[model samples]
Target: MDQDLNVVRGDSPDWRPPNKLLGQYLLSRLKLHGDRIIQAYPQYNETVTAAVVAERAVRYAATLQSLGVGCGDRVVVCCGIHPHYSSLLLGTICCGAACATLNNKFDSGDLRRLMEIIQPKVVFSMSDAVPQLQPALSQLATIPKLIVLDDEDTWKWFINNKIAYHEPQGIDPYTNVAAIMCSSGTSGLPKAVQITQANLFTSLMAFKHKDAYVQADDIVVITSPLFWVTALLYSLASMDHGVLLVLEFGASEEHVLGVIQQQKATVLFTASNFALSIAKQPSLNSYDFSRLRIVIATGTAMAMDTQILVENFFGASVVQLYGMTEILIATGMTRKGQRILGSVGLLVPTMKLKIVDPNTGISQGCGKVGELLFKGPQVSPGYLNNPEATAATFDAEGWVHSGDIGYADSDGNIFVTGRIKDIMKYRGHHVSPIELESILLSHPEVLEAAVIGVPHPTDVEHPRAYVVLKPGASVTADSLAELVASQVAEHKWLHGGVCFVNSLPKSPTGKIIRSELRYLTES
Candidate 1:
């Protein structure tokens, strides 16, 4: 406690490692502000302080140890957003165990597949989820001990009924797998990404930078599911900073806005769609959002106009962040720094970024569209239980392929164009669907849009678009195509044509399901 526990100690947005393990760092903060409210759950009307979280985490860690969970063992957590879930995650890591977070919304088949890969030593879930998880847990070659959260007997058995508490075990910060996060699996099957203790601690340190710093009085609201990397890391960072954290439990935009008004939240993190919904709220002006200092847009890219509109609507700086499950956060816009209109902002100090030619695997200079590659401590060790995937994605030189195509400006600000796999070819020229989709979203009548490449005889693959219009707003495909044609190059135009739809498929984090779009177009 006597030592300066600030994860970062610098004036700029540069990270300085605190030389402490993530669990060590989190527990060390208990020396200060132990009685201060650390987390608030409006859905349950529950509030917990730093002292209680630390105590619960330690007790849970001891409980896991008693269940034969040791260093490097896997513990699967399948539950919705709850304080107990956070406690379980921290406790699992504190006991030198790897916590594999399962998406609570996953179907039985997906659950079974992930469990088979994780082969967790112990499985924890809410009582409601136990029914579905039972069969999946049984399918595992080794049946894991199931712990249901909603049962009072669970607490009595794990905490209240226990007499002697086992001591928490220490972990190797660099080698210990603190958590296993699941990839989005938009392109293929979901793989478990192994995140090391050092990876998470480095991610936490990235927040201590000047423009992204969290003050002790800051109230941070997180609406994204805890399974998503963005929300999970932000919650941990807020707790590490001894700041108030609010878990909104996947609430509606209106409900979230109410919580922000009531809690006087200073920082908010949500997906672009949620931000868009908040922006489009007719009664948005009635809310007291003056206390907000920054609203971060992540999970997917926000349209340039939408970002500006949200910033103006909230009277707060709206910044875009770029990162994936493999990497915690690579680029972010600063509250007080220069924010480019369509860029994800300056690269973090912890990682190195390069744009490489997709076909030749050669590094491209600035302003060239190429596959983005990242190398740093924040990058996950590799995919768990799949050496082939680990080898396929990570190169021998240690660079992890991001599968994204984007270029950086002279100032090091990144402009994400589109996914490498999502690129379209027309007339032997490359086209990025995001450029066209962004144009469509800018239209006043369109609420959302997705673009993909469809097969063509001469053009090989031509651009096709699917658009969702705002309620009662009618727009013809010919008119939308004309609008896009007027704004883009001939080759980039929608040669494969356009279609109007009620809605586009989306992942849980709000990213467009391009594969589904491709399927629909092909069909």
Candidate 2:
């Protein structure tokens, strides 16, 4: 196992799975920790226990059953961070239906396109989301039945008019789809990722791997959107592992940090951009983060210096979980110098990893960078109904071709260099923007940075940078360019030039929208 084989067979302790549907497992956990306080929404001023959430789920399931909904049906949920979100998620599972997230973050146009792709039998909408969903629903050829969750009369009836029911038995874990998530990695339109029962089951357990695991009584401050995987995991973990989940409506730095301090949260699950926003907040020093134990960062490559600063600020180690919305690629914890600083730890023990040259089909050896492809039960089966995308991404051999550019050392430590399309071509050399961006982020005054390939007549394209500086810090573009020039090769220097911007464009989820930056260069 230690011969530096390019193909590493994932191995870890006690990964044997329990034979039950994800729904059944969820139901059991709900009963097991019925009295535990599982959810908190500071904005809503609500603190709910497992028992109350489960009752709502049971009623929601009963309502579904009365409406003839059952296994193999689709339910489009746009509840948008409400108190009923957990119950709706659990209720769909309890009824053997797959829930697709198209929360309020999406506009009417987004809903129109997604609804066409999903074609669900039922639309679960809260009052807050009706404005978006209704317009889209009206234009559909066969409009799905819209069920508003916040309708007081409907909820009162659903709660009072009890239909005695039990969870459907005999779910084939491997084939049955659990949930459909809409993912748009860095740019382009969104695609629906189909997560099977087995995939979700394996993902949950993979998070519990010994290197980094969540225990009972741990308060997890969730900053990700409810549709995103981190939010789903933390919500479910509240029931399964007896952890306390602190929830939030998306995108407000003050409220999120205050929740962490008020709740005395121990674990933080977030993306690199959101984490940086927290780091840049003027009021950050006022808060007491002494209770924070682990900061789990994902979505992009975290710069080493920024990682160190975040670690020192929170007084906790930053554990990077590298994967797209499609799958969780790799994660491991730190012990002194046991982990490489910039590396995204080892491949998840339940999955197998191999770096493959994108141009050729050949496997890459240790320390050779290539496109990473992984295989495991946790890996998604494919995109729902989008056969072309599914075929292009997931191969016949079960390897999910990750478009990410990365390499693995002999220790199986994965280092994500950049994305396939993002690598800039300069003077016949491949220049990684992530590599340059990482170096740019290391500067003390740089609040945020994004790198792109600005077109050049002779050299295919040249690397350009857009930077946001901290308030009152006046570091010039030349010093920043020199910083990158000293660290990387001459060709990888910011040849197109550096532009100091007031702020960088970001998605609602806080991911840098590189397309917008590229647009700025053209404009």
Candidate 3:
């Protein structure tokens, strides 16, 4: 062995080896604890062992290979709240194929549009989602090979009849594509982000070694759907570390608390909205959350007050992570450092982050807000088949122009201000809707809030606020408007007035649909 290898294998204080392939690493953990419970789906009462999961994944890979899915072929997997979805993802990765996970909640028209855009070679849909998928499938020019999951009757027949058995071929980790995740595409059409095996492995390595929030003995509760990037990474990390994954379908406070209490989950990865909901639960104190160590909030920013309440309730700091489908989880605040509120912490060890002026493309100094750019192994190579959009987003030097606008402090902590495109220009002054929305959410009577910019008859453009009040907590529009005016500058003040609504429209991932809000205002 080489001297470096010898040091890594040896018990040295400063020697540490890097993690390589995710599948091999996870499989080795399965070999150690073959019988231990790895995945639990409460709705179905299905508990899967690490060994069973690996075997099923291998078999599924064989099935995909028979259908002509090989390296670089895109296989779109539309998943619901099924335990088998994770297995399907693993199987696709093992076969060296990229799995594009579609949101199950999309209507037929939207689904068809995405299918036409991606042009996947194969698709895997649950038996329950078939009714909704049929119309979309009919519209595709070249229909993908359909694989039905959770149909025991048909699956049993295939297994019993001695179908063709094939072995899973090992793949080169450095060059193979692993998965494709769609961005929300709030500005325009959703884009398919092609995440390679190296990208996935790099993010997992950072989470394991550099982040050090997750451990092999930790029990992780997965409250978000596997279709999303954050939830998928949590499961992959847990499996890679030989930890237990307790998954719940919905984000209901009651269901989440029950699973956490029953499983004694030590870690949780969820959206900020879900965490806020859990914090606001009337009976939150009833659950024993002392066993919890880490609470990771992504998808949206957590309110400062809500974060404090949740930390006090669980005795754990709520770590805020900044990530997207393009780069997975890039920046995260540690529990110990979370005391510095409103910051997303430093960039990951292997990653490089920069804030550049959107128009000039010049790097900005500390505290100067600009578009965030990232370059690293965790960043996706490009959008699949959309070279125009890919080239536009990724520069010649390989930096990903993340539409998000933020400034890094002198200490290297990143604070995401808002999306550059989402910034409302009122009388030539730029205003971030996130800033306005955050102040609105700070109001004790407001449960949720969203802000949008609409074309104004007199001012060219103006800000509007939509709020969902706390149950039974009454507040009039004038009062709400005054509250916002008191917090913001003259140009940043709401010109369109406050509007009370039962609920604001949200994307499948729980982000407020600002375009829809503008549409509502225009109508």
lDDT scores in order: 0.79, 0.79, 0.74
Instruction: Sum up the clashes in candidate 2.
Output: 0
Q: On a 0 to 1 TM-score scale, where does candidate 3 land against the true structure?
A: 0.89
> Compared with the true structure, what per-residue lDDT tens digits does model 2 show for residues 1-523?
2455568656664667876778778878888888888888876889888888888888888877777768877888876677777887788888888888776768888888888888887887788888988888888787777877779876566557678667787778788776888886334578888878777777777556665546676888877787777777667777677788888757477777788889999988888777866775545768877899888788777867777777776778787778766774455533333667777777666778878899997888888889988888778878877888888888899988888888877667778888888899999999988878878877778888999999999999989999998888879999999999998889999999899998999877777888888888889
Tens-place lDDT digits, model 1, residues 1-523? 0022211111233556676767767888764768888888898899988888888888888788888898889999888887776677788877788988888888888888889889999988888887779888898888998888777887569765353445445567888999998994325788999999889988887777676635667898888787888767866765687778888756777788899999999988888777866775556678887899988888766667668877888899888888989988888834466688877877676677877788997767657778888878888889898888888888887888888888876566788888888888888798988779878877778777888999998879989988888778878899999999999889988888888888889887777888888888767
How much lDDT does candidate 3 score?
0.74
What's the TM-score of each model vs. the native? 0.93, 0.95, 0.89
* Candidate order by decreasing TM-score: 2, 1, 3
RMSD (Å) per prediction: 4.8, 2.1, 5.4
How many clashes (backbone N, Cα, C below 3 Å) per candidate?
0, 0, 0
| Better structure of 2 and 3 per TM-score | 2
TM-score of 2: 0.95
Better of 1 and 3 by lDDT: 1
Which residue pairs clash within candidate 3? none
Off by over 4 Å in 3: 1-22, 117-121, 139-142, 157-171, 281-284, 303-306, 312-315, 333-339
